[model samples]
Target: MSSSSAPTSGTLTYDQAGVNYDLIDPLKVSAQRAAAATASHLASHGFTEVAASRGESAYVVDVGPFYIASIVECLGSKALVADEMATLTGRSWYDGIAQDTIAMAVNDLITVGATPLVVQAYWAAGGSDWFGDAQRAQSLVAGWKKACEVCNVAWGGGETPALAGIVEGGRIDLAASCTGLINPKERLSVGDRLQAGDAIVLLDSSGIHANGLSLARKLVERLPEGWLTEIDPVNHPGLTYGAALLAPTVLYSPVTEALWQAGIVPHYCANITGHGWRKLLRHPATLTYRIHTVPPVTPVLAFIQQHAQQDDREAYSTLNMGAGFALFMAPEDAQRTVEIAQGLGIGARIAGQVEAGPKQLLIEPLGIRFGDDDLQLR
Candidate 1:
């Protein structure tokens, strides 16, 4: 299904809301450069760094028989939304918040075909009093354990610091780092196998998966009822806007593991996070991604676009829309991938293909095309 475009007037783009990638990307480039210089230091520990993996989702290290992949990610501003929604709904949402934090890190780790082994939590609060609520604190602990089980990773100990001045007193900042293993050596995927004619299989996301919450929160301010607003008054009654926004992110580590167990090695994979659909072309290669179809967007996302006055390009560039993760593999393996995900009770579909052309993405259904300039993660 396609999203209806709102008129240009009063358009609420992501940058206007607070996040300006133009300013953020340059720092990424700087970090990548600085990080590259430190790669040589690894040899002292008898480990060789995978130079090509530097700018990828997960960093890889050659440790003799297998590679170790690691990624650190945060839940962004979604936690703040959960805090507000909890006050409005009179229910603790920290379980989903904990899950969202782990998913953010684990999802990125799995893109390289790594099986997550351990996840370390980083929960920082403005004050120690933030954890004084028994219900909220216990929900967070239980949720973290549950999400770790879902990802098949150990909940390694983490630090919960009380930074009174740095963080807002009422809110806590959530983040995590995941370390995974890529065994059998052949399981590693960093787009080296990507080629023309590869089919693009998309995995469905459960609502907004912790990427565009900043803009989502901004959109909520314009609503008359704010967090208490019903997402779809006629169809999905009682589903408040806050409840929809707080939906836990889908953990994709199992899906990647299932694909490997089925002998389907995706040429490349991407966790559709901050960059939105532009992430489809994230592999640093000169190829054109032609998407013939898109997944059905969730009602909350549709509501955000319609209410925020975001056009097709703006909405597609900012939010997941519906497709959370992408897998590019041989055309023959595409259906098998979809079936494997479906077997796991997750939505999947063959959405597009890669063609030999310039580095760009063409969403045929929406006539939206994003050039290489749109994404600058490297």
Candidate 2:
């Protein structure tokens, strides 16, 4: 029998299929409201044209000729996986997840055309054993140092809490907040200069860069026996799947810096995460993104597609689909941008172009169109 007809042994509800909006909806609403309140407060305080007006990453405060942007993000469900890593690899769980925490926070700051200046982490752990405490502290500091060095940012102090009964099995929660500065003259906003035929450049991702694991985990859990034990079955090195998944999020500072040096300023930029183009369309404008090509879909993504029988739209909507950072540059600047990224040893490709539309995303070849409601932050 073909895979689709093999069997319907167990039913899969949307929730069981790994979409739990009950928990996700409240948080999403709260975040949207908080962002709106912040935007209003900033405007009331005499700031003009907050980038929050355009929804890329965070609220950008217009300070004279410059803009200061701040972004905060937690490690998300991957924290649970990092904790499991301690048991699986006999390594410190905190060390496993710390760099990832910092990466998540800083990447968003850069998405809004800011250079990260400092990063701070907030850690939570259930009654820490002596070994756990020492290891976590050591790992967090080490991770912070590494991240700071790579991104050329300062490592601000962090918070660590030992909650007695709230957390289970000595679980540790990791989160980071980042601050960056962008010259207002240099800040980029979605649709600000984005026009038809402008090139869409894609920066290759480092395997599942910190989003959509809620669904990936569910897919893994549903896999039949012997699947997990096989090496290279998922196209990624089987032995390092966990470590690769936990790989520190790539810092795009180098890419952004290179673009700045090359004098190829993008009109719009976004760090492709949780919601993909849905997040990109936060700005209220009538435009369509036509993605003509994509980077090679890594094995892990392909495996998920094959196993879950996920359609193209669902897969791209939930996962990064191999593009980590997207750049919307002038049609004339696309080649130079790709050259600059390649010079930095980063793989880059032209994924799509922008066009006049009713503010929708039309993914060609795949024949998927995301309407206004589909892009809304629910």
Instruction: Report RMSD (Å) for each prediction in the order shown.
Output: 3.7, 4.5
| lDDT of candidates 1 onward, in order | 0.90, 0.70
TM-score of each: 0.96, 0.86
Estimate, for each residue in 220-278, the C-alpha lDDT of model 1 and write its tens digit. 77788989899899989999899999999999988999999999999999999987998
Candidate 2's TM-score reads 0.86
Q: How accurate is candidate 2 locally (lDDT)?
A: 0.70
Off by over 4 Å in 2: 1-14, 17-19, 22-54, 93-96, 130-137, 224-228, 231-237
* CA lDDT, candidate 2, residue 291: 83
What does the lDDT come to for candidate 1? 0.90
